[model samples]
Target: MSAHAINDRRHGQTTLAHFFFAFVRGPCKLLSSGAWGERCRLAKFGGECIHSDFHICEDAGRMGNHVASELPKSCDVENLWLCERASVVMAKFSVLLFLREQWTVLVVTGTNVGLGFEAAVHLAKLKPKRLLLTTRDEAKCKQAKQDVEQCSVTNNIEAWPLELGSFDSVRKFADRIESEGFPINAFIANASIATFTYAKTQDGWETTLQVNYLSTALLSILMLPHLIKSTTASDTARLVIVASDAHFRANKLKGVANWPSILGKLNDEEYCTASVMKNRYELSKLLQVMFVREPASRLPNPTPVSVTSINPGFCHSRLTRSVESNLVMKLMVHVGKALLARTTEMGSRALMHPAVEPSERDRHGRYMSCVEVAEESDYALSEEGKEISRRLWEETIEILAKIDPRVNQIISQHLLAR
Candidate 1:
């Protein structure tokens, strides 16, 4: 009769249900190899098991630890963990399905192809009030809009133009969204690039730094007012940023210690070489994590808009196609993909999971991996990381304020002051 006793009884029931479904529906299959390194594509798709979609692994590592502690006498541990990972993701999606409803409005970027497109399709199925998909190319955006239309009954999906490489374009897009007067329930900053080539945006910043970090920070800040307006007593708006696990591999940059002018060091031509480009994307993602974390910390408790970054893991996408100029790098990437890549569909689930799932609102400013809240890189959590995050936040606001005066107004009026 006690609360603890009742909870334990329910957990026992759920376990029995999972085992029964696993056995009767079909054996959980390991469709591919590399359980951890690559993540074996588990054969639990198409709802093969009824309860497969109901169980979300709160602690992503819990199942792996469980499998390790109680490995079957003659079983392959890696394959077993693969099954666990597959089940966890599938279960997580089902939870989303259960919570599905007509969302007020949601926006996704880089939807011409890959994860963004796939995520748009999944979100469309929810039949939101409006689903805006943006891409840099008009023709491709139109085609993507048509493709998404065919997959779902949501007729409100619209394709818009957005070029992250230019701050003007980013500001214009935000202007249009704000002018529309519709409260944005969720904004997914999913567009990004990874290339060995060095270049600068029209804003005179490194291409990766501008597109992946600067422009993204700008748009998120510009849109904060709308996101906050959308929040109410019953629901809070969400800002879901598609970051990456590669942030863990990010090399500490010399520029970060430069304080207010850190962007200057990154923009220096010498620092943008093909060699330094090896970790360019990773570094940008680290900056993004820091950017999101600082703002999340500043927002008042019971925050109106919840900001979170997600690591969809490595999936097959055009994000790095521009690196074709480097044969050796291309070959290395090819092998890495072949060995360990999740489908865009799987990756998209990670992208949309936090956006639609109400439970994830509490994870403001946290990093999500495999659909669960996970710790960020050691450097990102160190005292040094804190200092860099502080400087990055100030610099971002400064630069954005120069581009659009609205940035300062939004931060001062919408977000908590330092």
Candidate 2:
């Protein structure tokens, strides 16, 4: 059978969808059906072929007829078919993936720490036009910038100080980035506080809530303009929040109504006495997921900003060691860590994948674990949860409004800008 005859037969028997599936699954079937002759005819004419041989032929033709003649012998027809199909699929997907857009900048928080540091290092390899690495500690940010620069000379990475626990700090950081006049392509809310003590931040909010949830929400709102400015009709930017699986564990302790209040008082005691800190940490992580999903459902405008939450799996980090230090605690931590823990590099892989990989661009507003998008808790997406995140957003504005009306104004201005 000639290639044309085979295509006509297949076209008569199959739908376009089936053809696409077959094309992707096994283009060799197309080759075996004798599509190569039709492709060759197409190549001979002014038209083009969809197989890899066509591309090789075209490249060779660019050199000369002599080169073109040699290509048929030099290139394997089967491999060319596969490559052609792969290229076509990628090109079509890029229409939805936003891979061709330039000027997408990634803002990474807490870039100094274990997973954050590792993510920054890996993301640098992807060569985003600009990367903003923010942290509360200036020294740490500088070190992280140095490390990332060392790893890849191609990425334009810079450092800025951002203390998520304080509304003041978040505003200043956002202002600085906006002043730079760069649109944010992605934002990773990776900074978190896992203190055992029920401390209040300078802003007079619970330390856990302020740092892990409220501040990140505020920062996102403040940076919304920059994100929007960067997005095209064809492009959708992303916000990836690094949450944890611990939220599920904390939700299980729901029946103990007064447990949070009681634990708040005991937070200052030694590690042996402040076991409840584990629950506090878990609660904050839960809130982070809630904030992402809640806004995703209710945001008036799809906002061109896709919000995603990811659990990077367990990793052996300073944060993990901080909570489990004693012999028994260490033993349990060791077992869990060994079984579930990924290296900082592996843990950050999911994050970097979401941030830079074109494949994940369409998977917006989803919760992910180990690169697979997973379902979040029902409460996190419930109306009540949406209201909770809304209340947190409003209260955060009110608090910032009181501290510096200018800061609140700037944040509001940015959110509503453009």
Task: Highest TM-score: give the candidate number.
Answer: 1
What digit string (tens of lDDT, one per residue) describes model 1 on residues 1-418?
2111111232222122322232222122222211111122333342222222123232345454544444333334444343443333332233333343454688999998999998898788767779999999789889999999998756889999999999989988988987888889889999999876788776788888899999999999988888998887767889999898677667776656654477777778986776788789888998999999988988888899999998776678888798866798789879867766656676677777778666546788888765567777767888988898888888788888999999888888877877
lDDT of 2 at 296: 59
Error of 1 at 13 (Å): 41
Model 2 alpha-carbon drift over 4 Å, by segment: 1-102, 252-276, 300-302, 325-327, 359-362, 378-418
C-alpha lDDT score of every prediction, in listed order: 0.72, 0.59
> Measured by TM-score, how close is model 2 to the native structure?
0.67
- Model 1: how far residue 206 lies from native, Å: 1.3
Candidate 2 per-residue C-alpha lDDT over 9-87 given as tens digits, one digit per residue, 9 for 90 to 100: 3222212332232223222222211111122211211112333333222121133345345444434433443323221
**Model 1 TM-score, all chains together:** 0.79
Q: How close is each model in CA RMSD to the real structure?
A: 10.6, 13.4
